[model samples]
Target: MEYELIDNTQAKQYEYHIEGVLAKIEYIKTKDKIYLTHTEVPKQLEGKGIASSLVHSVLEDIEKKDLTLIPMCPFVAAYIKRHPDWKKLVLKGINIS
Candidate 1:
């Protein structure tokens, strides 16, 4: 499944609304980097692969904007681990362990 990742800059998060619920990845943006700090998907929507999609969208957006990523959220970190190609989008000099 695919969804548009809404970069709600005013909310400091990327949002996706599906089935009338909001799924979001919160971020903190600096001049050259964005710290993906948390991910939230309602319990009713778990186990549906939505979180991975959200993370992918956020990573793609960060890459398009040329901003480094700091995956502070454990969920985002695990997603990156599973999708290693996206590691190139991470901020340099930071260990995501």
Candidate 2:
């Protein structure tokens, strides 16, 4: 799927758009950690794996910038659990449960 991923810094979110629907992963950044706050896919675009892809790309960008992750969103937390390699990007001393 060739989805267009956009880092909408003004909105503090990463958005992936396909056709007219959008999937977004919201975040808040601090000096060293990016707190992922929410993940949402339009109801019309549900069950297409868009949420997973959005978070995957978002995490990749965070890794490239060498910032830690604070998975405040349940979806993002579960994503890190599935992709153990991303666990290293999570900030220390944060309870992910």
Candidate 3:
């Protein structure tokens, strides 16, 4: 499967897509952090790891841009918890807050 990130400025959100299936992600930007609020991968796309892939891609972007992440989305939080090495990319205080 192929994934792409689209910034939906009109909706004030970012979206991940695998073909035509869209995964909605809510984000809030602070001076030094990007907080991922919520994520939803359609039921038809469940169990296929699309959400994981989307989270990975978003994290990659964060790293490349030298931005810290506040993973408010449960899926993203769990993903960071699983990858301790990536914990370095998380913004301080925001993790617990």
Q: Rate the local accuracy (lDDT) of all candidates.
A: 0.90, 0.87, 0.80
Better of 2 and 3 by lDDT: 2
Candidate ordering by lDDT (highest first): 1, 2, 3
Clashing pairs in 3: none
Q: What is the C-alpha lDDT profile of model 3 across 6-84, one tens digit per residue? A: 7675775678866577787888876778888999999888998888787887788778878888788888898888877
- Model 3 regions more than 4 Å off: 93-97
Per-residue CA lDDT of model 2 for 76-95, tens digit only, reads: 99888888888889988766
Candidate 2 similarity to native, TM-score: 0.91
For model 2, name the residue pairs that clash. Answer: none
Pairs in clash, predicted candidate 1: none
Instruction: Provide the RMSD of all predictions against the true structure, rounded to 1 decimal.
Output: 0.9, 1.3, 2.2
Model 1 TM-score, all chains together: 0.94
Reference-based lDDT, residue 4, model 1: 79
Q: What would you estimate as the lDDT of candidate 1?
A: 0.90
Better of 1 and 2 by lDDT: 1
Off by over 4 Å in 2: 95-97
Poorest stretch of ten by lDDT in candidate 3: 88-97
Better of 1 and 3 by TM-score: 1
Better of 1 and 3 by lDDT: 1
